[model samples]
Target chain A: MANVTAVTREPSSEQELPHPYLLFLGDTVHPGFAKTAFGLKQWAPELCLGQFALPSAQIDLGLPNLRPAEARAKGARALVIGVANSGGFIAASWIPALVEALQDGLDIISGMHARLGDIAELRYTAERHGRQLIDIRTPPPRIPIATGLKRSGKRLLTVGTDCALGKKYAALSIARAFAERGVDADFRATGQTGIMIAGSGIPMDAVVSDFAAGAAELLSPDAAPDHWDVVEGQGSILHPAYAGVSLALLHGSQPDVFVVCHDPGRTHLLGDEQFALPPVEEIIDLTVRLGSRTNPAIRCGGIALNTSKLEAQEAEALCAAESRRLGLPVADPIRGGPAFDALIENCLAAPASS
Target chain B: MANVTAVTREPSSEQELPHPYLLFLGDTVHPGFAKTAFGLKQWAPELCLGQFALPSAQIDLGLPNLRPAEARAKGARALVIGVANSGGFIAASWIPALVEALQDGLDIISGMHARLGDIAELRYTAERHGRQLIDIRTPPPRIPIATGLKRSGKRLLTVGTDCALGKKYAALSIARAFAERGVDADFRATGQTGIMIAGSGIPMDAVVSDFAAGAAELLSPDAAPDHWDVVEGQGSILHPAYAGVSLALLHGSQPDVFVVCHDPGRTHLLGDEQFALPPVEEIIDLTVRLGSRTNPAIRCGGIALNTSKLEAQEAEALCAAESRRLGLPVADPIRGGPAFDALIENCLAAPASS
Candidate 1:
């Protein structure tokens, strides 16, 4: 974290980067692994200049294919590692391409478990070329354990049924919707892509376990009485692997209201399909019961379903049915309309218990 | 964990250290901060040769007082850091004394959040002296995310109502009782002190939040059909700050049965007294419901009450009353008499629901 490591400093909050990026997809064949690129292209399309990937890569951003030099020529200031490679390591085969990008006059950025500064080739190349090697996942130094104190202002966190569903999208959409309604709100990111979009957040999963809750507390600090910090959530509490991160975020944020984000199409938990996803009703019940330790007035806002697979008519019918059954608003953020608007209104309704 | 840091490598399981120790109490006044020392003295007294503390320190182990050279002459090989400093950082005031220990030809062992090898003076001194600077809280590398696959054999985890109120002691005692009963059982350490005693464990708090449960899985892998891993627990499920760590351990261990460890006299949580402790009934209910995600047959073993503050007669009466009322064995581990034996026996009584 200091003199021994190549990178000398950790970002205090969200890390900033050069605009107009060339997204590096590496050799990712699975679309899930290339979420970073997809997220950035979706949320900050204007900043993403082009896309680059190995020939073996199967997924695409549909942006122009450009080498680092070509992107640099088109005013791209950085080459962002857009794909989350399996095992969180920079693949040995991908080194030459990363080195080439550095040599082509662009800064390099990554959000992997392994630090970019630890890679000798990339570290040396960046130092020689005077370009930055930024790691977005690094949490700030001296994050104290959470006090469990209820902070000022309103908070709406996006809880989920599983990982990589629609938590971040739901949070971003809710924050945007609040803004459009002339409500003071901010999108509080908690992952790599969201951090890139919002320019700040604590990577909840990357933090040491003991300080995970504390980091969440820091991510959305106490605000004004009427302001809302729309907190982007991480893994689901029902998830076997990452639930700890999810629980920590829950306890630390102590959100007054929460929305369940789910991929209605997914029958089972992501990664390990042996277990099925808990229903939205179960998520709301548990989030309230557990979150009450910090904020006794905790309530559920509604359900945010990622009905991306269904046809428009089918999706609307499904939402309507689910809404009727659960007695709560349900909508896909991307398919924003009356349903989505109702969700925004539902979020602000005080005494809104699930 | 590799070339970038002073320690060239990480252990795959619990870190091992030289035996026959001098416990370093630092300049601590609160006994709570020196739990490592207290736990070791209680569980592995034979390995503790003497106690070492600064003049300002008020807590004592009641063992022979010795300097590094004196303890070394008395057959101590490692100077164990007994105190967990308030901020988890080694104070500058304690440095000169630590240096004196390193100069006296013994390894310096610690379980602090900050790495001993990261401290320039200590790192250089250890390097010059060719002595190990052991950090017991270092977790295994390449800890995979938990799959939540239930493993072979029976497991009993010591869950708690709060931190440091006898979870480790209860696990150790239960495992010992199992051994005495001619049952095949292994004590799985989850914290620093337990690691030092058992010679292998994953420091649950030190793991990345994403892999906290994964690390717990590695700590007690698949075992024999008749074997029982008495997995030591960490934070409480009701804890605002550390419940994530607790939940991860719970899901990863996936204990068929669990015992609730609590301090009977405490009205509120340890560090933060703003919140009151949730009833043991609440812990059992939530644990069973949430734990059913990975382990549908999860059951409560009993209650382990740390009744150290009460008189002997009062403690026995209180435990007996609680046992009768709750229909679950309740006993103080330290006072291992009839009640303690019943608690241990009840742990094996299958279908032991709360």
Candidate 2:
């Protein structure tokens, strides 16, 4: 019943997010859940100032840990909430720190399902300090149901075997690689973290079920015939809870080619342990089968293996082994090298026979 | 914010929906899109007093047509929307008639995605007349992510080859038949019309993608040792747009057994004609394959065929032939007879071995 004066940023609100940002990890220990922070630090490091964590936090971003005032003094523009728990809820314990950020002359930006403006103390603090509360997770006002009609231009989507396995990173890398190769391309973000880094995206998780795929379509509309939309995917098609989001993204994006992103270390899904992560082969098959309903030309590009847990040489050996077994280029997008270039080359070149 | 006071009926609001209703068909010509009206007419004829339609309405429920005033005068308490368009949006052209209904002392109960109270004129009219503007397509306040834990007791979900293909009707029929046979059972609604009929349900489509499955889990929780929760399903797992919703519901309900609902006439998906409906065999296979993640013991029960377009003898012949082909009982629930009873019997008996 409170005044529905919640913020509605302008069309270019992605540009409204000022930088350098102070990443807020809260007290989350799991790296998978803190993907937003890790992604920003990885993709937009120049725009980031430092990190902040609650005392009970066990994870760190390797950046300097500073308080709100210190970060504000260091010319940080906003405190970006980076961790996403099961529900994307804003914890009550973090409110004091959030309010401090506002009082310390920094705006608060969040991709959380629970709106920051909806919290009374934060809203009051923001209003008093003239600080902004930007929620990039908000979808557009009107999104039609999926037309199931293919649009012009090519698209390459990054899918995964589980929830947070570097789909966004692969997308960002492929888009950048394409740009470097003098091919016109764009990184289309489907989730919150990708949206933050790319400056705009449809928060697939926040969308209603009916309009989920439609939102994806609108995000990457018909572009020039040669242009490519390197779309970042969401939840896995095999995940117990978020598979719907992933499938909706797949159908909507209708990628001409897709890359399988996987964390080889994860046996079970990120949060739900009942379900095991399907093999990269299963993900490719399902993505193609379901995605073909929208685009018949859909095919796999390669695999972006997240070899974070492996030694450099060991990761290379695994990538080599996977490439040999699957007959597709496999490489870690983060460890960009000749292998990643080969993977990108296979994706953008003439479509593979398979 | 317009006071944010449009309406909020208590938890007992389902009981507050005054019956002996006037079904409102607003300018809709397609019979397939008007499944809600047809469903109520077929399943709950006694509570349906009469029909009301706009000048442009081409579809009819075969009940005596009456204006809101006439129906109200004849003791109809509410005007229930019985049509679902592409997006469940209320047409602006029908606003005048809706206002007239409110003026005539009839509450307006709609399962529309666009809320009646959100329309200024409708809200003002309802407030002025002290008539409740009930929106049934509302998810509960809190829904957790699907735990993927198989609950106790049993569940029989009615999935379909496509949407609006007698899934809700099939579920309602199964539940009622179970009760008739002295089996402990309950009808769990998933969509608006089903909820309106069942008195309570979670509108799966309205929920956020993250909590979509979780909402389904909450809807049909653990029941008595031998009780059956016959959940009304939504959208097809093969549907281009709504497959995510269907898959989420499938995983969430984790049905011990499921019936494949289909309209023999519909070749393609509703609204989106690009997709061809998968065969009943495919539906059963996919339902069991994907649904096995949550409930490994899941299996196909039977099939509920909608044979409204065929001759009585032709319908029976098709059901018989298809039953032989698929090795499962098949019958039109609306065409209740020995065949229908046999279909229910097969479903409730030992879960049929595939």
Candidate 3:
């Protein structure tokens, strides 16, 4: 396993921040909740207290849906909004429960686009209870405009076919794989959940549009030449709703090598039904071409398949077919297999001269 | 001339703003002052009052430089800092003159990256005088994250080789040219001077990095099908100092066609002596390919040459040679020529099947 350092924010001397024991608030029906819970459980098991679901909701992720009072009683210090819904607005129905948590002196933390601080009631309750309302989606302070200058060290980016198709997971997995091989690799998060886990990185989407790429550039400034920055990617170029963010990330990362993350079962681009997903080959070509504009040696290092929806046998066959088709190492990094090892080997090897 | 509409901010009813007779604060030695003055004269003639220069400096842009006292006495309501120096900061030497203008009750306006409001002395003086200090480079209120949705109507973007290489001039000239042909074309400014003249536009570089493209997208939302948006480009893909801005503009504009802006004499990319400007053909290819990732039909419509450094005869020869070589219309749009007409025709013509 990689020697992952959890970079937490410095607490004020007067009031040391409490270590968060999160009570994830989302139903199993919400894919966002599942994904968020899964990510936290896999990457940050220590912080996750348990899930908090409605009576009618099923607890499928194996985490118990503790009662709000029980959660707080069991050391749940923060109510983490795990649902990644469209527009990022918190559901009105969830407000009453969240208010109760705030009143009970539990801090509120969410990665949603909607800020709990923006809601007067939540802000008032949090203030009254001396509970912190942390909005993870807010952009970090004083992000400088990107100069697009080359920095020291090797960089690898995980670009995906669409949003939330496992770019972060692929990056993390790769970093883990690299670590297992005794390679010096670091994970650089660019989005909310990743930032929450990494404890740093610009919430790129929350940032003003002009500086998105600049923020990405800031993440991996000067580094040791032998070190590898496994930078997590954001939205997809084919994603009509978030392509600008994707482009900014692509340009900002300036990676020497990139792994294309793909969800083969995704028929249409998320948040955009009218457009169909372009062939993986087309996306790979586009990513490499656009990325190479800044770093001429940039190329597709491998392919990280999100085979969560596929059977093990089917996923293996698909990976084999893709490996043959693209002439690149292909595998689901999350699935324990030789694929992750092969991917690490491929990236560490010298890239062919373009 | 195109039916240019000045989109000025409404003054508060409690404080009726005075008509700004600007005292352009820069000597003839500073190209920024001359260019800002020239752009104002060409586009927003009604807004121009006069210039401001040091006693030892000459005013060569044909505008009379009034002394701080004379400028205010002669109806100058604002002191516009027009010297676009490296890093866009006002020099310490200019502070005394600026302070004098503020003391004389002139509001301060600047397009520099440095904020006059951030300077303690300037802020104190402006507050004491109840004068507004406007930084045109400050980002607009409530710029949404870009959806990358296909908006109605056609867009034509002017891309360039480097910063200050005439992307704005080329865009304006094309819009004017289109208007002469009875075409319904609009100029969408993405920089401060363009915003100043147009009376509306986002100072894209100042926007938080994420929303730069979103701001550009908002500029021409739901326009007529035949209406052409001549979007002003910022920086260059080859320019190390500002390529992030350029990429944001390129992706944000989402143009169906683009005119490549080139300053032929710029051997090295601006601000970075380590890198040289790639060939115009390579840039054109890169732009089209990168741009096509969003709108597949996006192509280079023509070439707008910034032949300001060349003599009339030399410019004409270069334009002709480029037109023949690239097989695209090429000319200095500022100089009276058929190049603009040729460009419009080329764009309106159905693109070849890629």
Candidate 4:
């Protein structure tokens, strides 16, 4: 049996240094490598100690590459698995290095689908050493089943044509814009990275299938009148790999209004290439219709286009074309434009009690 | 701790009688009481020992009411809680009587939302006496999460405007009609009475919210080219109390064609009286549209009218009027009619691979 500790540390003051963390990047580095590493650096730089990559790794994001011994010498208290892979499985070759780090008394944190606790040897070693093994992908506790009641005020959910196509970023941008406009809006996260940033919100995909919607419902609870709950969307309903999660979230949020997030440059749905992305208009219509099943007043308020791959001029031209064709506001939320303005206006104009 | 036994009883021969069951009916009796009692009698006669109801109870369909001691004397090996109540909670007043029956060495079977195993005193007594406590509403073992893959052959799902409005009866009727035509068809149940009739089918509502769809998918696996999987529907997507279960089933079944079941005599949604039923046309449109999200080819092939409360002539007139109004086949499945014939024809004409 493991000796479990229930320690409650006082919040550290700004003058005190942050707890140091080491990042473990196994083999098979890709764009995800930079995203995870740079994302941590940008969002939680106070906790980052350094990053460690295999000698054969391809990409680097300007973080110091250190050995386990060097990371320990530098006072790293935890090792965060920094590489993202398809299916979120930790490679077998990385197990030895991870075991070594756990044995050295550093707590481990991961956002992988294959949980660390399920790794028998690694879990046993971590337990024996009295070190923490945190799996960020696990669902939050005490999520109740959805009652499908009309929550107070209104909610705007950002749904995507596919995963990793900027749903969270769009939601955050919209919430920030609303905040700037002196509107009472809150951003609700539903994934690991967003949870890391928000410090609260459920890891939706990690939840058991039955209670996924319940988790989403809890995250976007009744807000004060005239307030907006901007909920982050997970997988796409058209996504063959994760439609169940997507449908659960869609039904769970029961948004008063929704924004369709799309990556126009991509020719195929992520992970499944057999089907192409449906037209933005079709997606918006489908989402609104599905959301309306729970809340009859649900509507697709706007569209958030992911045009990061295109040149600024090209992206602007595409957004304008999409706006004209779909008869809805369309723009990259990060780039900021009339789309966000129209989106906010449309959401604010919706019946508050809907 | 309970002394659990794993017994495999042989099928009873004609000369030998099956294990007898006594149904426990608490004070109040309603249509639900008769449905449960008569449903068990009609479906599984081998388990029908008799029903026990209070002397003051009113609605009796000619079933014998026996005391616990009398039932025990009649060779009842199990006592089934036969009365259906809102939220399925057992009445507190009935607990003592049920405990007495359990302590008398009779196994307990129930289809209530309140599981007997959760009752502290009754559970302790049952455990001490080595009596089995079975909650039929509990989900069956080994249900998987839905993957949204297209199974082989064709599927026809019965969607209702509300619960207890005969979604299962409609599906069963269509399946029976198809069978008479020499077509390979199977009825897949998703609720308690249907499960009891089929001898093996998942209780969709009892399942954890996440795996509800998975349970449906498992019940209706891939079929041959000419085969039809007639999947029984549960709660209505429009029903306030059970829409989550409805949505899960719709997405999970991925039916090629659907039949909309509605109680024309009912003026309001079941459980929630505030919302009036939408027009039959609207219901068909909504069901077809929601189902099409998972399977684009999904269409509302026909309509199943629940005209049980109406006179024969009135029911026929209503079905005819509805058939003309909705531009689809409509008839009470229980009443011999053209609705089932039209449904079978429409289903047979659907593209085989969809």
- Give per-residue CA lDDT, model 2, range B212-259, as digits (tens): 888888888877879999999998887778888998899889898899
Per-residue lDDT of candidate 1, residues B238-344 (tens digit): 89999999999999999889999988899899978898988999999999988888889898888999999999999999999999988899999889999999988
* CAPRI class of candidate 1: high
Worst 10 residues of 4 chain B by lDDT: B8-17
**Could you tell me which 10 consecutive residues in candidate 2 chain B have the lowest summed lDDT?**
B1-10
Weakest 10 consecutive residues of candidate 3 chain B by summed lDDT: B3-12
For model 3, the local distance difference test gives: 0.73
The candidate maximizing lDDT is 1
Write candidate 3's Cα lDDT for A201-253 as tens digits. Answer: 66777666666677778777778888998999987765544665676777777
Cand 1, B chain, TM: 0.87
Angstrom error of the Cα, residue A65, model 2: value is 11
lDDT of 3 by residue, B1-354 (tens): 111111123211222224455646554465554566667767766666777776655555556666667777877777766566667787777778778887886777777878887787777777776777777776656767666678788899988876778889888888887888888888887787786666556677766666666677777666898888888888776554455567667776888999888888988777666567777787788787667655778988888888888999999999999899998998888886666678778877777884
- iRMSD values, candidates in order: 0.6, 1.0, 3.5, 4.2
lDDT (tens digit, per residue) of candidate 2 on A1-354 = 232234443224354456789999898878988988998998878878899999988898999999999999999988999888888799999999999998998888888878998899998988888888888777766788888788999999898898777788889988989999999988887777877787677778888998888888887888899999999988788777887888888888889999999998999888767678888997888788778878888999999999999999999999999999999999999998989989988898886454
lDDT of 3 at B251: 73
Q: Which stretches of candidate 2 lie over 4 Å from their true place?
A: A1-38, A49-108, A120-132, B1-38, B46-108, B119-132, B352-354
Query: Which of the two candidates, 2 or 3, achieves a greater DockQ against the reference?
Result: 2
DockQ of every model listed? 0.83, 0.67, 0.30, 0.19
**Candidate number that wins on lDDT, 1 or 2:** 1
The candidate that wins on TM-score is 1
